[model samples]
Target: MLIGAEAVDTAVELNAYLARFGYGQGLSIQQLWAEMDRVWAEMGLDNRRPLGSQRIADFYAHPVWVLNGLFADTDPTSVRHRQAIAAFLKDACDDQARLRIADYGGGSGALARQIVDRLPGRSQIDLIEPFPSDFFRRRLGYRSEIRFHDVLSSDGYDVVIAQDVLEHVEQPIALAQRCIDATRQGGLVLFANCFYPCIQCHLPGTFYLRHTFRYVLASPALSYVGAVPGAAHVLIFRKHGEIDVAALVRRDRIARGVGPLLNLLGQFHSQMKTLGRRAGLSE
Candidate 1:
């Protein structure tokens, strides 16, 4: 029943965890955030360029991802996003119980907990995080309903969620396919990606999806279901079957061919929005 401020305070939890186990005993949460950034730089992860797949995997597998999730998952905006997704699920799966849900790269299991509270089901949540935080593991250890997985099966999930995951990968297309493949036919799949150059971890290579998400819409295996109403970033779809890989590849090729112009336009729009905010004309 906890919501808003009464919900888990990830900052406080992270601070305490760092003080107890990490090399951050005397540091504030802000300092820890900065230290994480510094460590990333020292590890050569913040090169601000497109990293290869192996490098991206190695970066994510490092223990720093634990800190990164703790720092990133509980802002006001992220809290509201979890609430919206929970509400959406409550309505979307009202008639169903015993749901099998998969959360792809779900970091700290906050959203999974929210969904469990709202859904009137004995659902099993498979948290597909390769590098799950120790905090998350210990906190949810007693909750058998929420299972952890380094990798997941290719199918049988009633719902598959990949919030804020696609942009961090080197091969987003392959990742997207896995998400789609993981869902059973007629099952739901939700994706929220920030394919912009917003942070060091969000790979620049994945920005191709910034303006080319229509390619996903055109897939034969999936039917576009609707955007999460309050959280426009989260899009829902239903998988029909396996994708027509050849057709999808051809469409993707065409999309990539036009990606440069689309990227330029997207950058121009962002610049204008920034300018408007600076001029006190927009928020």
Candidate 2:
């Protein structure tokens, strides 16, 4: 929603603010919270009406504000986040001279910057973010290897990264399919922050937690690589071939039917694990 010189100025100010915190140095939770508060105050949002009062669509429609509020600092997760994707690309592109990568819902260009900075060889990166910031647009002007798109296309990228995005969408399954379709055979798809209970425009449901991975694994197009589970889970999948639409639909329906039960069991398991850890019964 920010326009003209004000947007540009805010963008510059935000960059400087983040820099002071050692942007990629893996900030502690306390440091992250303090910096987030500082950034919110700097944006003059500290006194503004709470976002809950506004329609979720309108609140998120302001890409600049949403990104600034949620991601002012790259937290400790970023190091492992970047490394996972980088490792996948390195293996996938073995013996190849160049790679094509896409970041679906990549906000503020943080992950893209990390990939380009750490990875070697010539790579063409495309960011498919519907609501990218003015800062990101400006950065695109300077970075020749990266381009921005308002929508996903049949670009057939070698690697597609979608982090902290699925939980916010209305139709996560369809979006997941789109991400899979946009990837080439043997390409990697990195998904993180999938549906879990949290705040800010997250659709109400635990169906995704129970069945999304099952659906992904059932699809003939994809192969499960691994998962890193925590407060926010990270799932990795590899595209093998074209999707089996009929099979996917069938699996989705089945998942929906049994998802609630699975969700309950999953919650119970998580609670038990937490209890065990507290009781010093877990290694």
Instruction: Say which candidate scores most in TM-score.
Output: 1
Candidate 1 per-residue lDDT, tens place, 1-283, comes to 5446633575566566555534333334466556656556766774356565236566665555565555445556667888899899878887786789999988678888888887745678999997666667887887777889999788589999999888877677778888888889989999998887555676776676787875645776788888998899999999998888778777667776777689999789989998988989544
- What are the C-alpha RMSDs, in order, of all predicted structures? 7.1, 6.0
Would you list the C-alpha lDDT of every candidate in the order shown? 0.76, 0.66
Between which residue pairs do clashes occur in model 1? none
The estimated TM-scores of all candidates read 0.80, 0.74
Against the true structure, candidate 2 reaches a TM-score of: 0.74
Q: How many residue pairs clash (N, CA or C atoms closer than 3 angstroms) in each of the candidate models, in the order given? A: 0, 0
| Global fold similarity of model 1 (TM-score) | 0.80
lDDT of 2 by residue, 67-123 (tens): 343343345565566666666566656766777988888857776766676565467
Clashes of 1: 0
In terms of lDDT, the poorest run of 10 residues in model 1 is 20-29
